[model samples]
Target chain A: MKWLPRILGAAMLAGAAGVGIATALEAPAGDPQVVELLSGLNYVPSQSNIDVVLGEGAVEDLIEIAEDSSIDSDPGLRIRAFRSLGQYDGNPQRATAASALRRAIADYGAESSGTKLLYLRASMLSLAAIDGGNAVSNLVTMLGHPSRDIRAACAQALGITGVAAAIQPLRARDLIEPEEQVRLAIADALFLLGSKG
Target chain B: MSVLAATAAMLSLYLASGLACGGAGAGAPCQSHSECDDSYQCLAQVCSPKCTRNSDCGDGFQCNEAGVCNRVFANLGDPCGSEWDCEIGQSCVLEHGDSNDDQKLESSCQEQGEGGRVGSTCIADDDCRDSLCSLGHCSQLCRITDDCPDGNRCESIPRVLGVDDSAFFAGCIEDTSVLSTTIAMSESSGTLRIPVPSSAESFAIVAEVSDKIHLVGVTRVDSPSDFLLFRESDSFEGFLANPIRYARSKEVSTLIFPSNGVQEIEPGVYDVEIEASLPPFGPGTAVPKVSVHYKLRDSHILDLTFYFLNLEDHPCKESMGIDNLDKSSAKNSDVFQDEYLGEIHNIFGYANIVFPEEPEYVNLKRERPDLDGITDEQDLRDLFRLADNEDGLAIFFVRSLPSDGVQTLGTTIPGPPRTPGGPSSGIVVALDSLCYRSWTTLARITAHSMAGQMGLWNNRDPHGITDPIGDSDSSTGNLMYFGEFGGTELSEGQRRVLSLYPGLR
Candidate 1:
């Protein structure tokens, strides 16, 4: 009976070592590829090509890069990661991406207003592409954001969603929107929605 | 008394007699109110009785605020019977019709206003008084060529306003003035508060940092900061710490004010702070030079010089057919030139394209490997430095670009004005895409990049955010639409913005 227990412990130790080796092999291969692709996603023309390289773990990788606020993390890279997440619009794992985007939007900490704005803009577009009708209410709520750029981005995202529910919220915001640029965005959104209908 | 004085006295007496006798009835022609009956008024050179509403005035007339019937003036270029029947500064003139027969002659309001009277330069409509600051000078509104000064013609120019599609006005413009000034920079990183004269309509500032010194950012001094009008950067916070409108490029940083409709840069002394940093490979200290191109007057022609870089040794040359391109001389063949020119003409009817020089073949790839695939921002900057056309936009056509979806068809967002051989000198277009096989696509891409360089933002950015221009929509047909292809039409607002580009001679 004592010899049987010793044999079981030895088997368990071997299993743990195998798992560790598998993780080490996977991390090195996967991380660098993801980082390379993420770095290329900053501008418009290269975005589509990089999306092809993104794999099953891409959503989680993007979430990690987007949420990384460590001293070593590049703010521009994080913003790009947030934007790249939108490329997974039809993926089953998009809900997870959307949730990560939502958390990024809600968690306003030590980041500058401009940085926060960049995050919010990237999140709104991704949410619109990923969630569509489900993202309408959240987008509608952001229409009242204090920043003119944010409000305008939200209005535009609402239009991009192509959801009928977005139209009412946009119209309501149109009445009270004081900023001229925001008003123009709302009008454009309304026009887009009307055309969609 | 002299004969002229006696005649004038008699005419006044006759006019007094006419008024004393309740002279002309309604609808009768009269030069003055004295010729009309008492309680009636002479309006539009016609004797008319007091009226309460437009109905009482009959067709082609409206009751005036003064309780008199007045002839309704026709719009600009509309047919009219008399000067009185047309708007102020407009006159009825008869011209032979297309048939060239006396009987076929038609009369229309030929003169709209005395145009080309004010030669003062202006940047915006608010800069002029009672006249429009169009094409860099105060121009008089006109309906026909007859209203303009000698050598000037009434042109229907696009108007920059948040209005409908038919937003155009006729103005008198003939010549343009392009001027440049050089400011010697004492240091690599310092603020130069250049005094922009009130006479300068639109100006472009080009800062040429030493080869070792990379331009960090160019900030136009302003309160509360409007930094990075074209593209945002992570380093924006540092620039925004001091209130300014910040712009950044590679070796050469160009700042074009009123770059788009969203920005309305008035004519005043602008403090431009040029910031540069020494890259790891660069020298410790460098002297930068700043060149300012001031468009004192407006011009219709957009001069362009196309640089076809020789990609004979490029890695992708054989695959992309770069080796087949004629490298002996500038590819000035009529086949591609005519197509390129035709596309530009079709998009901008008012804009004329002038090739300053035959397209030159530059063996730049032999010197720089980075030119092969412009994947890095520095590579694009290096490619732009190969341009040598200062009087016009320098468009560099390369063999290939990074196939990564993020690779730009054109590198510069809004290319620097009047600068040559610098990072922001001009736009770099990659000819690698299968899309470039169609000359129409290539032309559209060129036109789009030119419009962007000329200060027009995308109708809608990739983030789904629309431009500040109200008239520009998300229509795929709009030339300024964010997509790389399909869009060909330019909105009136966009045309108006493009007219402000300093490169237009």
Candidate 2:
């Protein structure tokens, strides 16, 4: 199926060669979806694309999957694509948000590498805490990471999470940990989690 | 009947929680007066004002002008008369300067699905003690120090996994909050059968129940007749009459019924997937507990008549002319525990292919659940004769030893567990199967069945295998696979026997 990269019919994939690189800029290299998307970038895709490209089942599945971290089982564009979907409203959306975020955090941990990986993991964990209701467990564990940014982020998140349990961890860290600023943040987070441990 | 009246009579609606609630999805709205899942508290003793957090309430919810906690959402500014309007995370506070109706909870929305013993997070094993977070279930139990209830002891529950092994239940030998409960499911399909006390609510699901949702809705699409739920009828005996307390479409939301919130039962006939978030509202929930009962059925071998005995000489008389009824040599098999076919008990399989004189007309219909209107003596005889070619046909007689399935019963809990993974399968039998093509086998079987040839489908799980006959046997040694090169590792005699039959064209 390798053809010259053509965007919207004008040969965006013209440079596409064998099992290697892709010069197509509209999408990432080596991704057939990107190549296909490029080919039709010019052609007016019928509204059927709505149902075909982003079918209802796909949307719902994306929603269901995007909310959880385990769904990152598929290690490719599809996983990242689903994680980027939005949420529902009312009590229903409220209910699905919690574990979905927990899953997202878990999935991010498996995907990331190096220093930036910690940043991404921390960001995702923070995002999970906000989406899910007062999650002290995840937030507290996030504090255990080697990265100070992640620990600080988790400490801050733990405060707003509103679980009284978060206070003990923050206080525990304050007494034992040598880092003064981290201890200070823990003390403040304890105050926010609704208990000054 | 009025909704309330209908709900009251079906009294099971009061069955709170998991043992009953079926599947529900996301993004559906609900009036505070109507609720789903007992997790949401019914303030004022009636269904109203669900407060997951203080932020859900507009402005801020806290201890409002009234003592009840109020709730509020973020960024909408302070707009509330009481604190009860706040959400779970928010705390309603009174304005220091203003005394007139300024009661508001200033707090962020609380996190959802956390802060609990089982489903929530815990720093130490003690916090998670009361809950089991194994195998994707989040229920409270005390199996070990790791699975103990908060402040409880961990002891093994007697015969928890099965009769042979002692599964520990971690809890104080003298602990409280550990409740003993039981639930069951229908045995065969068609007529629902279960054994839950109509009154025991707040119990856990027993392991045996499968494909069982809280409420079961059976509708006859073709027939104009309205579907009826009964308990026990002559034609439709033991049907559920108004099986669900209340039934509704998208319009009619919650039904009014005094809910007890718990039920326990052993085994009996009941509805499937009928429990709803609303009391007896029936069917359709966010989390669906659906089970499936897969079966392969056949008909009764009603009449056995000896037609032609090739004792002297017959078509099946190979080269020489003879037949020996005594040397038929067949051994009755029982539960010998074959590694391949699970534990089969009392299996007697008889297959007969009818042969006729000078190409007589022949036909066959798989006789099972439905034999149609022709249930009389003459009709039954006629059907069998056509199937066996008026008089007799080619056939084989086979029987198997009796065997049991699943080593022991599994740990069955109601509702999705807070703890996701746990080991709870009672039936553990070693099986020697083709692992690589298992999925392909399933797909092929599915395709054949869907194409309306289910009667001819071959089950990968075989009857028995002391190792398929070796090099000399049929190549594939697939008795079920009729027209194929002999299965691998079959006996030469077996292959010769297969060669005697015509191959699949």
Candidate 3:
């Protein structure tokens, strides 16, 4: 499971290259099937359909589309890519995604304006999905961040990680956590960790 | 702690007992009043001087009306922390309408000198100057809507004191209005489509079913992409046998395409394809499912009355007496109503239980040792006796119910129960003791009753089969989710399903 993300990422990239050719040969770009496939790259892909597209070797294309500067320019499209990228469980290829998302996170922070909460949130979620040692450590560090959303996102990611090591840190954080919503996130994270164990 | 002790620990708050066997301490342990030395009677197992009058206690202390010597902690207009911090029987209330104080009280203990006027917040009747606390508000008691303040009407809400103890409190609350629309096969409206014109800013859908049938609907959005969003009603035989197609939506006709989108969204096309089908009816099985979609644009309301039934030797009812229950249940109901209002829809109407004299029916489970805690034939028979719903939902609060945990907090008949005579009406009998559980659990159980009444099924994952309607990918955060914990919301599908029932009509 620890190695799952990298393996899946590689498989996704290789399979995506083949799928990109196959899909183009099979149907025109605007086809409903194509639309559905492209919709997977859209901000909120259906969970059930996610596996289907990833299995069809569309993961690589999803990555490419997500990374494209033109698409990244659009908040909706960029967030969608980040979101899809975040769903990658254990793919080494996620390093590229992680870096891209990190930049987005940094850019959003630098701008320090507008309604890029969703973008930052999506990036954070992707970072959680593209699990690496750095992702885990960064998320844990976010537990004390000043932003409520960031703290909440970090708590949520830790829970999704299902890492037992997070339990103690979460419990310790909870003692000092002021916000009710953040406390709820930490409690939920603890429950998930305990349940996983 | 013994199992009994643990149960008691979870039951209620108690002043400390066995206080180091010391003297002078207010609630110190003692076998007799003489052990207190300071003259305190052993009331509620605590040694203290019992008094019939205020003159009995010396300076700095007064004999409370309850004949207990309590410190004269604070007086009206005096700053205090809690009611306990004030003189016994005197309530510490938050001073309202002091706008200059940053909406914060500088802290004061005011005498509950007057009866509760309309709109004042209260916990118990004693807190109200008028001696009436209804629905957590200092209600202006009234017999008719005219008696209430302007824009507020009198409602007959139940004063639930205990499982078997209830009384009616006719108090004024804001009036709830429901805008109803019908979903049926008519000559002009053939092919089964409900036009949710963009104009209706907010609304709720309420549908009803009298038989086993598939209620299907397609949410059409007028976006450039015709994303075919499809959902269907659960079948009657499996986990999907629930009638809830959707919970209340945040907005009118907001369809969440789980495949895409952020937050609840109204479809580009304000059109929905609806289809209702029943199993081939051959012998006495043809009940046309009547569905009314109330587009409660801004008024998302579903009213339900809880009838607390008294039964012989029922553990919950017998243990938690009416007065204690009234406070706890009222507090819980207030939270439940507020939760619904905050997350999904507004449950209108009343939040009281009718406590009728005489046991509705003997709880047969107490007599039959072999019956376990699962709700069986006799249980349903007893429950239906108290279910007096001509229409709309009914929550029959009871004492002992079947338990998989400490006790079964809630149980609902998914559809009409099958009997020798045939299937009749069903009831959602929740345990009277549910008031003791966390507010989250109480809310979940109450939501369960509404789901049952609306014909929504439980999320039957432990039972093996996952009903798509009941257990959807969007089940998380949904009120109908399979857990007793966590935040809850109404899914678009759930809202649509709930709208099929004439919940308000």
Task: Give the TM-scores of the predictions, in the order they appear.
Answer: 0.44, 0.19, 0.29
Distance from true position, residue B124, model 3, in Å? Answer: 36
Task: List iRMS for all predictions.
Answer: 27.9, 32.1, 25.7
For model 2, how does the per-residue alpha-carbon lDDT over B1-505 read when each residue is reduced to its tens digit?
Answer: 2222333332333344332333221112234423534433333233323444322222223323332334335432343322233333332222222233222112222222332434343332233322233212233332234323244333322111211112222222223221222222232223222212212221122222122233322221110122332222223222223231222222111111111111112211233222223224533443322221111012112111111111211111231112311112111111111211110100101111111112222112122111111112222222222223211111111000001000101111111111111121111110100111121222222121111111111212121122222232211233322111112121232222221111100
Best by DockQ: 1
lDDT of 3 by residue, A1-197 (tens): 12223333433453334211110111113323323333211015543455565564545655555555552233333445567777565555666667776766666543221235445555666776676436666567667766554565667677777777667778888899876656767877788778987
Whose TM-score is greatest here? 1
Where is model 1 more than 4 Å wrong at Cα? A1-197, B1-176, B187-191, B223-246, B262-265, B277-287, B311-323, B327-335, B350-375, B404-411, B435-437
lDDT measured at residue B77 in model 2 versus the true structure, 0 to 100: 36
Going through the candidates in the order shown, the clash numbers are 10, 169, 54
Ranking by DockQ: 1, 3, 2
Candidate 1 chain B: worst-modelled 10 consecutive residues by lDDT: B158-167
List the global CA lDDT of all models. 0.56, 0.27, 0.42
- In model 2, which runs have C-alpha deviations exceeding 4 angstroms? A1-97, A104-112, A115-134, A177-197, B1-505
lDDT of 1 by residue, B70-136 (tens): 6566776686533335554554443323233322224566554344333456654444542355545
Order the candidate numbers by lDDT, best to worst. Answer: 1, 3, 2
* Model 2 CAPRI quality: incorrect
Q: What is the C-alpha lDDT profile of model 1 across A1-197, one tens digit per residue?
A: 11223333433453344211110101112354454444331153233555555555767877888898776665445666787777778787789998987786677422323455566767887788788888887777788877655676688789888878999999999899876656767877788888999
